[model samples]
Target: MRRHRRAKIVATVGPASAAPDKLRALFLAGVDTFRLNFSHGLQEDHARVHAAIRALEQEVGRPIGILQDLQGPKIRIGTVKDGRLDLTAGETVRFVLDGSEGDKQAIPLCHPEIFAAAAPGQDLLIDDGRIRVRVVGLDADTLTAEVITGGPVSNRKGVNLPGTLLDLSPLTPKDRADLAFGLELGVDWVALSFVQKPSDVVEARALIGNRAGILSKIEKPQALERIGDIIRLSDAVMVARGDLGVEIPHEDVPGRQKELIRACRLAAKPVVVATQMLDSMVAAPAPTRAEASDVATAIYDGADAVMLSAESATGQYPVEAVTMMDRIIRSVEGHKLYRSIIATSDPGEEETPPHAVASATATLAEAVQASAIVTYTTSGTTTARVARKRPAVPILALTPHLATARRLCLMWGAHSVHTDDVDSYEEMTTKAADCAVQEEFARSSDLIVTTAGIPFQMAGNTNNIRVIQIQ
Candidate 1:
C-alpha cells in the first residue's frame, strides 16, 4: 500500500509476529521499518525474522530497513534461595559480590563496574525504578544501601544508577556477539543502547566500521548532557523512553523527546521516538485516547518515525496495534496542525553548499506546486536534507547503492529506490522524472524538482537543482 504520510513506522518483531504471513501483513499494513530487538530473541529467532523481511521486500519491490537494537550493559540483582525478598522501607540492604543467599541481610550484586563507581548518596533504582535505594556506605567489594522505597525485590531485576555515570563499556560481551550476528544477517541499522557520552558513540563506531548505519539509543540522563555531540557523531538517534523515563522525571520526557528530535533534524539525522507509544493496544483492539494523543504529539514534534515495542513485539493484538498506529499517524498527518507544526519547526543548520542548495528545493517546489522533489544521491545526504525541509510534496530518492536505499526507509518524507548510476546530468534528470511518473507520484507534464551532484559517483557532492516536466 502507498502511504501518503511522510513519517515512518517501526514495528518490533517477536513471537507474536514472527510468521511469514504475519510479517507480510504488517509490511502491507504500514510498517516502514522492522526492528529486531536483540535483547529477547535468540539468534535463530532473528534469522527467521530477517529471512521473512527479505522475502517480503522481494515480493513487494520495495526496500525495507531492519534495525538490530543491541542490548547494552544491563545491571540486575542476583537471585535468592527462596526466590523473592520482601524488604521493608528504611532498612539496610547489603549488595555484596558473592554467591550468598539473598535475604534481608545481603544479596549478590555481581556487577563490580557499578560498585566501583558507587558513592554515598547515589540513588539506585531497581526493577524499573519501582524500588528506590540510596547508597549509605561502600566497603571492599560491597555497597550498603538504604531502601528509601521498598517492595518485593525479585531475582534478576534490573538496576539503574541515575546521576552516576559508571565506568563501563556500553557494549557488553553479549552485545558484541549480537552485533556480529546482526552484521552477518545483513541488517541496515544497529542501535547502540545506553550511550552516556560522545566517546561511547565513537567507540561503537570503531567497531561498526561502516558496515551499517549506527543509531544511538538515548536512554540515560547523562546522554542528554552531551546530546548534541552524540547526535553529530551518530548516523541516527532513537529516543528510547522506556529507561529514559526511569532516569529522568516522567514529566520531563516529553520536552526531552522534542529536544532530541530537534537536535537530529538540525544535523539531518533520522530520529525515532520509541517505547509505549500505543500501550493499550497491547491487550485491546483499540488504544486509549491518551495513547493516540501521545503518538500525535511525536508526529507533530517532527520525528522521522514512531516505534512500537511491546505493543507490536509480544502483544496479543500485534496486527491491530500496527493498524491503529498507522491510522493514528495518517489521521494526524492529514490534520491542519501537522503542516503548521512542520512549517514552524526549526529549518535546520544548512552548512555546506549542497545543503543550502537542497534547502531551496523545498520552497521552489511549494511555490511551483511541483508533484515531487526528486533527489539523486550517492550517500543519501541530499534526500535527508530535503526531508528536513518538510515540503508539502513527497521526495523520491534514487541511489545506486542498495544499502543507501534500505537505510532511507527511516528517513521522513523519503521514498528511496535503487537504480543504476547516472553517467551525466541528463541521465539523472531522466531517471528522476521517470521514477516520478512510474511511481505515480506525478503525471505527464507535471513539474518535478530534481537535485544531484555533477559527478554522480562522488559522495556528498550534491550541487545542482532543476525543475523538469515529466514526459
Candidate 2:
C-alpha cells in the first residue's frame, strides 16, 4: 500500500494483535515497521511473530522492518515487606543487598552494583518517579537513603537514578539470548534500551556486528550528556520518552525530542520519536485531542517516525489508532506550510560524496519536478542521506538486500521496495522505474531521478546521478 505522507509508523506486536490476519491489517493500515518487545513475550512467541512478519513481507511484496527491543539492565528494589511499604518524608530507608521482607526501616535492593556506584546526595526515583529518595550514605552492604518525596514502594518497582552513571551494560543475559534469536530471524533493527555512553553502542555493535542496525534508545540522563557521540556511534536513534520523561521532567521532553530529531537530521541518521503517541486509543476508539496533537507535533518536528506502543499492542482500537495517526500525518503534511517548515532546516554544507550526490538529487528533482527520487541502495545509507534533505517528492529506495530495504522504513519520505540487483546502469533504471510504476508512485512518461554507484558490484560508490522519463 502507498502512504500519502513522509513520516513512517511503527506498530508493536503483542497478544492483542498477534494473529496473521491482524498483523497484515496493521501493515495495510500504514505500519512501516513492527517492534517486538522482548520485555513481554517469550522467545517462542516472538519467533512466531517474526515468522508471521516475514510471511506478510513475502505476500505483500514489500520490505517490512522488524525491530527487536532488548530489555536492558533492570534496576529495581527487591520484594518489600507486607507486599508493600509506605515511606514518609524525612524518614530514612535502608536498601540492602540481602533480599528480605522488612517494615518501614529497610527495603531490599539486590543489585550490588547500584549500591557500589551510588553516592551521597544522588536522587533515586522509583515507579517512574512517583517515589523519590536521596542517597544519604552508601556502604559495602547497604545504601542509606532519605525519603524526599515519599509514596508507596511496591515489590520490584523500577528504580531510576538520574545522578550517577550506574555501572551496567545496556544488555543483560536475557538480552544476549534475545539478540541471538533476533539476528537468527533476520531482524532489521535491534533497539538497545537505556543507552548511556558510546560504549553501550559499541558493546551491542560488537555482538550484532554487521548483522543488524543498532538503534540507541535514548532514555537515560547520562545519554543526553554525550548524545552526539552516541548518535555518531549508533546506526540510528530513538527518543524513548517513556523512561526519559521519568529521568527528567515532563517539560523537558519536548525540547529534548526536538533536539534529537534535529541532531539526527544533521547527522543523516534515522531517528524515531516513540512512546504514547496515541495512548488513549488503548481503551477508546478515538484518540484524545492531546494525543492527536502529539502525533502531529512529531510529524511537524520532522521525526522520521512516530511510534504506537500499548495503543497498537493491546489497544481496543489498534487499526483505528494507526488509521487516525496516518490521517493526522497526511493532514499536517498537506498543509501549505509543511514544506516551508521543513525547508527551514536546510541541508548541511557538506561536500562529501554521499552528501553532494544527495543534495544534487534533491535539487535536480525539484528543478524538474520529478515524480520521485529512485535510490538503489545496499546498506540504506543513500536513502538516509536523501531523506535528510526532506525533498518535496517521495523517495523510492530500491534495494536488492531485503534487510536494507526493511531498515529504510524508518526514514522520512522513504518508500522501500525490494528488487533484484542491477547489473548495469540501464538495468538499474529500468528495474527501479518498473518497481516505482508497480508501486503506483509514478505513471508512464513521468519524470524520475535515479542514483547509484557506477560499478554496480561495488558498494558506497554512489558517484552517478541521472534523470529519466518513463516510456
Candidate 3:
C-alpha cells in the first residue's frame, strides 16, 4: 500500500485494542505501526499481539511495523501497607530500607541504591508528582524526607528524581529479558525507555545485535545533556514527552522537541514524537483542538512519526485516534510550509564533516532532479541528515545494520534497505544504484544521488557524494 501521509502513525496496543479484530480495524484505520509496551503487557499478551499483527500484515498485503517498548530501570516505591496514604504539606516522612515490611506510618524503601544516591535537599516526585518530598536526612537504615507538596500516595507509585542521579544501571534484568523476547518475536523495533547516555544504546545494541532496531526514548534530562552522542550511537530516537515533560520545565518541552528533531534530521536518524497526542480521546470519541494542533506541529516539524500512548492502547476510541492522527498528518503535509520546514537547514558556520556532506548531497539532488537519493549509513546519521532536506524524490537508505532499517521505518519519505557495507566508494555507489532499481525507486535510465565516505569509515562518516544513472 502506498503511504498517504508523510508522517507515520504509531498506535499502542493494550486491553482496549489487543484483540485481533480490533488490531485489524486499527491497521485499516491508518496505523502504520503497532507499539507493544512491555511495561504493562505480559509475555503471552505480546505473543498474541505479535500473531495478530502478522495476520493483519498478510491480510492487508503491506508491511506493518511492530515496536516493542522495553521498560527500562523503572524506580518505584515498595507496596504501601494501607494501599494509600495522605501526606500534608511540610509533614515529615521516613522511608526505611528495612526488609521487615508493613507499616502504617512509614513506607518501605526497597531500592537501597536510591537511598545511597539521594542527598539532602534533593526533590523526589512520587506517582508523576502527585506527592512531592524533599530529602531531609540520610541514614544507614532509613532516609528521612519532608513532604514539600502533599497528595494521595498509593502502593508501588513511581519515583522520579530529577537532579539526583541514581547509582543504578539504565537497563534492568527485565529490560534485557524483554529485548531477547522482542528479538525472538521478530519485532521490527525495540524502544529503550529512560536512556540516560550513549552507553545505554551501545549496551542495548550489543544485546539486540541485528535482530531489531533500537529506538532510544529521550525522556530524561540526562539524555538531553548527552543527546549528540546518543543520536550518534542510536538507530533512532523517540521524544518521549510523558516523562520528559515531568523531568524538565513544561515550557521547555517544545524547544527540546524541536532541538531533538533537528539534531536527528542532521544526523539522518528517524525521530518519533510520542505521548499524549490525542489524550482526550481516551474518553471522548474525538480529540481536542489543541491535541489536533499538537499532532500537526510534529508533522510540520518534520518528525518521522507521531505516537499515541494510552489514547490508542487503552482508550475507548483507539481506532478513531489513529484515524484522526492520519487525517491531521495528511492535511498538514499538503501545505507548502510542511515541506519547506523540513527542507530548511541551519548549517553552522564551521560545518562538521557529516553536515558538509549532507548539505552537498541535498544540493546535488535538487540540481540533478534525481529520481532518488541513496544513502549508506551505519548509525543512520547520514540518512537522517538527508531526510531533513526533504528532497522531492524518494530517499533510499541502505544500511548493513538491521536496527537502522527498523528504526528508519518511522522516518518521513525514507525507505530503508538492509545490505552489506561496501569497502570502497565505487562498490557503495554501484550497490546503492542496484538497490534503488530493485526497490523501483529509480528506473534503469533515471539519475540517482548517492552519498558515503572514502576508506570505509564508520556509519556516520558520509564525506563523499556522487550522481549516477541507474543501469
lDDT of 2: 0.88
**Candidate 1 lDDT, 106-129, residue by residue in tens:** 788989887888899999999999
TM-score-best of 1 and 3: 1
Give one digit per residue, the lDDT tens place, for model 2 in 117-236. 788999989999999999998898878888999878888899988856888989999999999999998899999999999999999988999899999999998999999999999989
Better of 2 and 3 by lDDT: 2
**Top-lDDT structure, candidate number:** 1
Whole-model lDDT values for every prediction: 0.90, 0.88, 0.82
The per-residue C-alpha lDDT of model 2 at residue 318 equals 91
TM-score of every prediction relative to native:
0.98, 0.97, 0.84
Which regions of candidate 1 are displaced past 4 Å? none
Error of 2 at 406 (Å): 1.1
Better structure of 1 and 2 per lDDT:
1
TM-score top scorer: 1
